[model samples]
Target: MKKIVYAGLFTFFVSVISFTARAESTVGYFGFEPDIITNYIGPSSKKMGYVRVTIDLMLTDTSDIAVVEHHTPLLRDALVEILSKEPEEKIKSLTGREEIRAKCAE
Candidate 1:
């Protein structure tokens, strides 16, 4: 009985450790090329200021890095289109910027 109990405990511990190691997330940061995105702010009569944005993507698993990099151009174009639609005032405010970012995330 004693031997059986110890063996069961050891097996449980080993399995638990193995499961935890496998379950751990492998995180990676991927930066799209041409890191800086520069575009003129929305409809302004006077000299329109340009907004420069730097975007970096975080992947829960390293495998996603390739997938995201492959779609970089599409991501950039979408972001540019979204920003271009926003008014100059929206780009200037924190809330507005957050809203824009949320939209891009969606």
Candidate 2:
């Protein structure tokens, strides 16, 4: 009985550790969500006007959607760089929305 209990306990611990070792990042793990600015808020928003952008980002192994709250700037920067010169037409339009989603998925 004692040997059986020890064997079962050992198996449980090993399985638990193995499960943790196999985690994978989901599409939402890009660390941040895209932000669309429709209006400025003085010095806080600077001279930037309302614009839409799609951000495609690489995800860190441990990142998730929740981390987006902390990485908003990163997402905006990436989107701006990739989708520059057409923020208004690209982000606000229906086609742009689809493009944004496609880019983000990749």
Candidate 3:
């Protein structure tokens, strides 16, 4: 009976340690570089402005950071393309920003 109890305790301790390590490993944030979209014309069609954006990736795993970084170029290109196509009115509003955020998050 004593030997069984000891084995159980050992198993529990090992499981707790593994759970703690995994929990710790999955906590943090990673920010991508700023992206700028230039030469975009405003409502007036004559006035031009640029849109600058930075994205922060909420990561639950450290390995995800490396994965995100690896695809940074493609991600940047897609985001820039999306931002460049947006009209001045859409880009200037709070809702528009939220919409953009959602799109990027997706």
lDDT of 3 at 56: 74
Q: Candidate 2 residues 10-102, lDDT tens each?
A: 999999888877654243435234354444223343555555433345555345555765767766655555554445556566988788677
Give the worst 10-residue stretch by lDDT in candidate 2: 36-45
Q: Please give the ranking of all candidate structures by lDDT, highest first, separated by commas.
A: 1, 3, 2
List TM-scores for all candidates, in order.
0.68, 0.32, 0.68
Give the per-residue lDDT of model 1 (tens digit) for 1-106. Answer: 9999999999999999999998796998987667555566556566567787887878888998888888888888888888777788888999999998899788
lDDT, each prediction: 0.81, 0.57, 0.80
lDDT of 3: 0.80
lDDT of 3 by residue, 26-73 (tens): 656777655455456788978889988767778877778888888888
Q: Quick one: RMSD of model 1?
A: 5.3
Candidate 2: list runs displaced more than 4 Å.
1-48, 52-76
